[model samples]
Target: MFISISIPLADETRVRPYTIASSPEDGDLFEIVFNRVPGGAGVAWLFERKAGDEINFTGPFGAFTLERAPERELVFIAEGTAIAPIRPMLRRVFEQKPGHPVRLLYAADRVEHLLFRGEIEGHAIAHPQFQFETIIADGGQEALYARIMAEVERRWVVTDNDRMRHFYVCGIGAGVLRIRDLLRGAGYERRAVRYEQW
Candidate 1:
């Protein structure tokens, strides 16, 4: 869903849209992740925030809620910074479906490009039901495809081919769609894969 964050200026306020990264289970506060752009006004404005600073942001609006795929395995694919929205969704899976198998394939150009790397890796370490893989896409398209394909095949070994499955892809622009396509081409139903949208 979309969240409106406002930067208060002397005579006016500027607003930007960011995805909500917290689930209702996370309590009253909603978390959002953003990076500083090279020459971005909003980035500059947001960076000036202090720990106790107050910023104007509104709503956790969206229909991209998590579902209980009890009859199927749940797979999440995230690219670069898309982990922001997927974080709480993944958390919900852990909360609502205790023993279910959940797999996450997150890709970035480099280790430094990954967000919440430690957090996600730590979660996977603590939870045996969840499997995680990181793909460094700097190795070219063919290499990236091979890595993801291997991970998918590995998951298939444990996952029932006859059982239904749901795939969630979250990332910037075409990246998410490309992942969706990969999953679809791998024999998953078109309707089973969901991607983040504008």
Candidate 2:
């Protein structure tokens, strides 16, 4: 499901490829979530978008997708806006197998900064097989206050069967590095983990 979009050049330079967040059944509109960085062209342009605005993009271009494999558990680890893709992937996963053991660990600076928190909770509450955990890096609350590394390690390697579950981590540069290191330490079998770091 690929479409071309005409995103305005926020930095007067380039229009980056952003995974449209909307599900294919949702129709013609493509939803994307991004933050404005200091010099990020895509984010800058995306920030100025209004309803009815036009943007250009190419693809459906990720090798990563939610394929039904009920025998295997799955884990999604996202930081900040990276949850956009995870959201859709979860939708696909649940649609195919409502009771599959899928864990979502979303890390953010604060609860307010957590994207799709309500939606995550709703899914967890509605489905017994879906589990959701949030780690706040700001330490402003009693909830998991560890960095992503510490928080993520809790579930990286499922010891029950010694079978490394599928792991996906998405975030910025340093955050991605930390996740990779954490997974490596957790004995995740390397190949079972997929990552997308901005």
Candidate 3:
């Protein structure tokens, strides 16, 4: 689908790539969720959009295209609205490899603020191999207590096939880097990790 997006400014013009947050079959109009950050370029405008406002964008770009292959396991790590790319990937993966092992770990400031929780949960129920863990930064749950970098290391066991599993991570600059380092340290082959930086 093609869209023409207009924000509060002109210089930001360009059809930025964005995964349709809503299900693709849901139709032409879709939502792209984002947090308002201090001096944030794209997000600042995105968060302020009113209902029915026209925004220009062409997608689903990058190497993160949503497609499925039964041979590979999937690991999705997302922070805030970075889930954009991961969400569509999951939908496509499930459609093709219904029983493939897929895990999604999303970090958020609070449980109430988690994005697409219901969708992820439903996916997990339908596909046993699909599991989701929500890490609330301020929550007391053990899974939510540690930083994302440490958590990835603690969970994944490095093996000869570590290079085979697909890893998708997106978020703030620092968090993305830290997770990359952790993955490398955990014996994940450098070539195995795919990252999208915001």
Candidate 4:
């Protein structure tokens, strides 16, 4: 879900949408992640703030959350900080359906840029039905898409229960659209895919 963060400035306030990164299981401690981009006022203000500093924000709005999709397999594709929403969703999935098969295809240009990689990999190790893979988008031309398609074929498309699957894609807008297009072009119904892009 998305939240509107309010930054109290000298003259006025600045508001920006942030997807809560912390799991609802994290309780009162909500976390939001961002890279401080140059000339980004909200990002700058957020980074400069210290603990206990007051800020205002509203809404857990977005239609990216889970839905009633029968007993479907779940696949999450995320890039960079787009992993924010996926974390909480994954946690919820594990909490609600530990034995359900879940796969994550995480893309980043560099290994260091992939957030919580080790932590999630650890989850994969512990959860028998959980699997995770990393894709470096810039490594080669169309390499990321190729890898994602390969994963879909190997993990989802080939499965006997392929029709009973839900795909969640989160990343930059273009990437999300491209993946959705690829999946649709490959014959997966549009309703089976859900996305949140920035």
Give me the candidate number with maximum lDDT.
4
Model 1 alpha-carbon miss at residue 120, Å: 2.1
lDDT of 1 at 171: 65
Candidate 2: residue 161 Cα off by (Å):
7.6
What is candidate 4's local distance difference test score?
A: 0.77
Q: Report every candidate's CA lDDT.
A: 0.73, 0.69, 0.69, 0.77
Query: Candidate 2: deviation at residue 64, Å?
Result: 2.3
lDDT tens readout by residue for model 4, 56-101: 8789888888633236677888887889889878777876754467
Residue pairs clashing in model 4 are none
Q: What's each prediction's TM-score? A: 0.75, 0.80, 0.77, 0.81
- Model 3 lDDT per residue over 84-184, tens place: 76777788788786545788989887776678889889998988998898777865323342577666776775424455576888876666877777777
**What does candidate 2's lDDT look like per residue over 67-145, in tens digits?**
6544567888887777877778888887776444788888887688798788889888877988898777775322232
Q: Pick the candidate with the highest TM-score.
A: 4
Model 3, which residues run further than 4 Å from truth?
1-6, 10-19, 56-60, 139-146, 157-163
How big is the positional error of residue 68 in model 1, measured in Å on the Cα after superposition?
Answer: 2.3
- Arranged by TM-score with the best first, the candidates are 4, 2, 3, 1
* Tens-digit lDDT string for candidate 1 (1-198): 768888876667888778877677668776777867568777688888889988778775776667564556788877666777788877777767565678888887788978888888887987898888888878754565556656665665336564267888776555456566766777778878878843
The segments of candidate 2 whose C-alpha lies over 4 angstroms from its true place after superposition are 1-12, 39-41, 98-100, 139-146, 157-161
**C-alpha positional error of residue 135 in candidate 2 after TM-score superposition, expressed in Å:** 1.3
After superposition on all CA atoms, what RMSD does each candidate show versus the true structure? 4.1, 3.9, 4.2, 3.4
Task: Give the lDDT of residue 33 in candidate 4.
Answer: 87
